[model samples]
Target: MVQLGSRAGAPGRHVVLCAEQISKSFAGVRALHNVDFDLRHGEVHALMGENGAGKSTLMKILAGVHTSYDGSIQVEGQAASFSGVRDAEEAGIAIIHQELNLVPELSVAANIFLGREPLIGGVLIDRRSMIRAAERLLARLGVTIPPETRISGLRVGEQQLVEIAKALSLNARILIMDEPTSALSSSECDTLFKIVRQLASEGVAIIYTSHRIEEVLELADRVTVLRDGRRVVTAPIGELSRGAIISAMVGREITANESGKTAQDGAVVLSVRNLTLDTLGPHGWRRTLHGVSFELRRGEILGIGGLLGSGRTEILESIFGVSRGWRDGNIAIDGAPVDINSPADAYRLGVALVSEDRKERGLHLGASICDNVALPSIGVLSRFGLRSFASERALAADMVKRLSVRCSGIGQDVAALSGGNQQKVVIGKWLGTEPRILLLDEPTRGIDIGAKQEIYRLIFDLAAQGLGIIVVTSEMPELLLLSDRILVMCEGRQTGILARENATQEQVMRLAAPGMAAWSQVSAS
Candidate 1:
């Protein structure tokens, strides 16, 4: 853990970045009140807050993404005004947003040097040199990516690396990262942390934001608490434990999930046997899901646990009918075979999925909250080849109320909402479908504690109504609390199935670990 602060005014050491009495508002609703914050050179400053706590608003003001904020920002002991993101970059500040800003059609090199590419003799374009330069920059950040590869061909983790490389290419003095590790696996996160340490060593000021308190303690040199747009306290990482940080962030006590919930009423509602997908990949017709089988019951929550590339995602994909063609499978809903060839087909048969990646697979960010929330039920809102906008708005308003979604209005753009609110919209969209079965993939991964609690309550509510739910999550405590049973996968095989009564963190880890069990026997015990 990092120490909170050093002695006051000991020699020529002042903050490199400082904000005084910052305030912001939208339509008379104050998002951030008078808040003061600072970042010193060679320090990792963690910003802590919950949904609607105004952390993002403050960061946006500092990044110059919002010019209407009222504040005095001093850089290197001189007051400065930044009108736009470019101005901030020019001031040696860079922000890697949670939502990646890369163009998919462009190559890695092109994205890294997007607006400011090095020129050949200040005239002709130098493509080869740009690629080499991008490669070197990526290497410096401990990121391995092919510069010539199109960003569209990469996974979410690889694309995140591209964003980091872009920040490094600017040689920025201050770097801001918003939930950079929300989608990264353990190893990939290790790579990112290594780069953070390296940059801190070079005197680059860093402002880090994340929902994971443990990660903040491990990586941040100092922690800053923000609540309802007010600065609470700034302390060294070593000065605060995870419990204290959570209490400060939420302004309340949060009991950890110490024990697992007991399974109840386990009559199977969904059953699949001998499910196999033989698709040609880098390896020929490789068995991605080898005779996978599982059982889920009415009013039950089943968990699927595994690391990246452990076939956990494939199982969800197969169940949702999004995977490559599969063969010889017996899928039953209430002991009846159901044909599922597409998402619409599965949906019609009463199945809905909150996919693993929300931005790509779930939402249309440019669309309004009304449109996104009502998308799944548009047919019902449509009549005589015409849609009723009023009806759609009413339905959206109701769903928003039910989900406790925070937003400006149903007419507000989804992209403008906070990350947790955006995720709520995704769930609301699915809830509008009114499915009998729900498959959620990492549903609460990036959300704050308050929003997460809402989602958990919603899950239990849905299950209480007798809707069978299967959740795939990397967070073990979530599995313990939200799931009635867990199915562990290791390398495209079913390793073990533990009921909540018998499921311990150690048991789930063992089943999800290497060389445990095959997919054929993974159960919903």
Candidate 2:
């Protein structure tokens, strides 16, 4: 492991990687500007900022993903420029992007050595040796996954581990992990942290990017804040607090408005009984949701909280027709049973769902903002084999103004907006359909505080108009603030449900965990 001098003035040490005057642009937008960064050997440097803060752009330049960047890179005190990722890898640099890059049908070993495979007899590919090498790498990282298993057969966490192994196979001295824990379970994250510590101990310089503030403070040795394509601040982890870091990233004061929701007495509008989804386990084992049920009244907000695989998301999806199977469940809208066999069927039944994966499943990125907003209600705007563009624009314009969606115009592409505004577009599409019951899955994920406030205001407005809302969230504070009633799920079952006035963070977390003694009592009550 190479040693480096700390900011506190230490002895002779080597700076493994250095960047000076890094500038990058896409189209006409400057993604990064004069960014100077240096990584010492055996250090985990965290890049902190909100979405679209140029952190990823800067890292992409270092990984050679963006070859057009104007910058001088010095590795071992020698000026260098990489034309491609292969060039960077040859220079001992590798990056594991936030999005998984692997062929689902391919085996773990195949993915590890995809571009550079070992050859045998100067002709045939060595399959057995590749699997053996993959197994060895997995063993070194303290992760247990069969090398012969296809990536499609593995969980998201296991696939992420495969990516890490792929980088390690390059003998990369500098590793960049982008949002590594975004899709990991708590135990899987612990395993990843252990591996990260091991790599740091072996003098591997890591540049980590994550939105989770707590994890950054715990793992990163030094933190760098970027805002609006410029470097804002750099300091050791101990020198900055969470509040200070957030301020640096946004360059302004940010605050969350705690919802003071008053208790509501309203008639039931939507009811679900015995909803279930069949799920496959690690080794082709099947698990079923055992008789999940819930009810929401008009002018009321219901919150769902659970672990990642606890069937919370599945339940909402089932209600919205995202999951299609023989659902032996009773779904009632306004005291009338309805068969929601498809998304269109659910929409006709006055039920709208904002899916968790907004970018992929909900919004059409290439479509204009007006078109995306009118997608759910395009039928209403159509007339005699022709659609009213004026009406569509008017509807979308009103929604954009009402939701405070910051966009250039109604003609702007949905992809041009920020994460928060994109989310508003998702909600707008549903609201334009004019559903009586709304189902939201992580609506506020990856958004800023001002946008969050706008979303909360919209939810409250809909509820006040006698609409029923069901929100599924991983954030405890969001669950507490926005819910009139809370339902907690664990291990494919309902663990507890509480009235919002009586629910606390401590109480919610206790019930949300698997196999607690309060499960039966809380469920019964």
Question: Per-residue lDDT of 1-525 in model 2, one digit per residue for the tens?
Answer: 222323232112468889998988888899888988988887888997877789888888889898888879998788879899988998899999876899989999999999778899878889999999999999876677989889987645578789988988998999999888765555556667877877777778889888777878888888988888899998888899988988898787777665545436778899888876776545664554667888889888899987666777778878887674445688898888888778999988889999876876789999999999987887888888688888899899989998888888999999888778999999998899889999998887666545666788888888888889999876677788899888887777777788876888887767767775235636422
- Cα deviation of 204 in candidate 2 (Å)? 1.9
Worst 10 residues of 1 by lDDT: 2-11
* Tens-place lDDT digits, model 1, residues 1-525: 322232222113458999999999998889998999989887889999997788888888889898888879999998989899999999999999887899999999999999888888999769988999998988875666779888986667678788888888999999999888876755567677877877776678899999988789888878998988888888888789998888898899987543223436657678989777766543246776767788888888888887656777777777778887555577988888987878888888889989877878889988999999888888878988799888899889998898888887898998887667888899889888888889998898778977777778888888877888999887777878888888887777777888777888888877776667533464546
Q: Each candidate: what lDDT? A: 0.81, 0.81
- Tell me the spans in candidate 1 whose CA falls farther than 4 Å from its real position: 1-14, 118-129, 132-145, 256-264, 278-288, 324-328, 366-368, 381-394, 407-412, 501-524
List the pairs of residues colliding in candidate 1: 3-236, 4-235, 4-236, 493-518, 493-519, 494-518, 494-519
Best by lDDT: 1
Global CA lDDT computed for model 2: 0.81
Instruction: State each model's C-alpha RMSD to the native.
Output: 4.0, 3.8
TM-score for every candidate vs. truth? 0.86, 0.87
In model 2, how large is the Cα lDDT of residue 176? 91
The list of candidate 2 runs beyond 4 A from truth reads 1-13, 107-109, 117-165, 168-171, 279-285, 447-461, 501-510, 514-521
